[model samples]
Target: MSITVEKFVEEGRDPFSLEVVAGHEYLGRIIKEAALNRPGLALAGFFQHFAHLRVQVLGLAENAYLKSLTPDERGQRLHRLYQKKIPCVVLTRNRQPSSEILECAEAFKVPILKTPMITNRFINLATLLMENLTAPLVRYQGTMLEIMGIGVLMEGQAGIGKSETALALIERGHSLVSDDLTVLRKDSTGAIVGYADDMTRYHMEIRGLGIIHVPSLFGVASMRREMHLDLVVRLERFDPKKEYDRTGLNSETISILGADVPLLTIPVAAGRDIAHVVEVAALNQKLKQLGHDAAKELDEKLVRALERKRRM
Candidate 1:
């Protein structure tokens, strides 16, 4: 997903009336402070760790190290730093930009944001700015399980063993995607793909087994970073009154990101091989894509038989 680019400003303030600067993000927000200005909250520490290319700290304050420079010397120093060509520079304490720095900023298209926030408070917000700016792209929640060479998304209501099914699949040679929640993204060509978040990449929770690492137990082939979401199999308790599609004649699909994906509503009964059914469904969908429809062929054969009997 593409983000709307806007000018950098001080955090906790309105975005309008701010000077235009060079910055790009899916969600634009202003940073309140810089590492030099805000020393307590460790905003600089956070920025140092996140390593996001999008954030730029502006106008640093005067420390003993920086105060050594005279006005002209400071201007030269600012120019040298600006030459690095970061996303933007934040000017703390609402200080005015030097003519040389301003000219260099304008020339390089680097935005200079001014804010009254002291350094410590500014760093706190800068961390937030980086955190919220990047929206989740092609990621999933929880743990994904791999089984039978298929990326099965074990989905069910809360506590219905979605993660457990995924864990089982992983033990049986499938891969994990996400556990409880999965973030879905659609590409430009209308393909929906899913991925595991960096934090929750290969972790899963089983009832008695506690937290087990899928990749460690199953090896590299048992894990996948992303999958195309070829099928959606929803598991539900068996309803006696409901008329399930025993013949597999109907074509049911699930819509995600403006595209229809093959869907299977498998009922969970005692001793039912849900994983096997899902694998077969995925294989069948592949066959259908190659123009082999078993149900259609059977229907055609039955129709021909009926016509022959009528003629006889």
Candidate 2:
């Protein structure tokens, strides 16, 4: 997916206050590439390998270089650089563009933006936002919640009580990221980050309860905007005939947006406290991350005891 320059300026948050200085009509230009480029070499009349498709950034050094040039020289260089039809240009540290550059921007119909953030800070923030905005995404029918700091995605068939389980977790001091439908995206580091849809964010549907706002009823502490999905818990109805894994040694995983997240299946019954079971599953996942696997340890101990008995 591509992000428009106009959307970037409008939706950009703290550390990236972008204001368009020129080319208002070109705000509709799409930023197809997530990576940014410093146009220092391009301004020096080098066009062999110019990354014209990426967002051009003018930092302290580039701005100072422009000021040192003669008016005619600066105008010529700016004109040549903008001729490449770059997506957009951003001036960092609230630096004012030279008249030649601004004129070139208007003449070439390229959008020029300015931000108060320093060079490196702005680049980092912009790149991050661009990457996230264009990242691969998948929507799952589940409820995402944070239990003991671990992101647990409760997934099952419709009307399987995903939202009710999340509500219970909230009552237990946990936080809800999304309910009903969770949008998962793979970040740059290959971790799956889950977020709520704009329309459904902080809203949960319960049987006979209708649509309810989670944060409004549970307070701000019970809701989160987004979270890195760490584990998936599948709630299945208890069945006497179905054989389930009795030991916790099952290394099950569910793939979402190309990231494999650990999965746990809990049998749900009339008296089963599924909320508490999911909470324990999340805590167990944390322990596994800390290099402790209780199931494996138990199996190893049993093997050792069997070997000793044979020796005796």
lDDT leader: 2
Candidate 2 lDDT by residue in tens digits, 249-312 = 8789887877788988888889888998999889999999999999999999999999999999
Clashing pairs in 2: none
For model 2, where is the 10-residue window of minimal lDDT? 8-17
What lDDT tens digits, residue by residue, belong to model 1 across residues 37-115? 3221122222333322344444354333345567676666555554544445555666676575567676666655656
Candidate 1 C-alpha error for residue 266, in Å = 0.2
Regions more than 4 Å wrong, model 2? 13-15
Q: How does model 1 fare in lDDT?
A: 0.57
Clashes of 2: 0
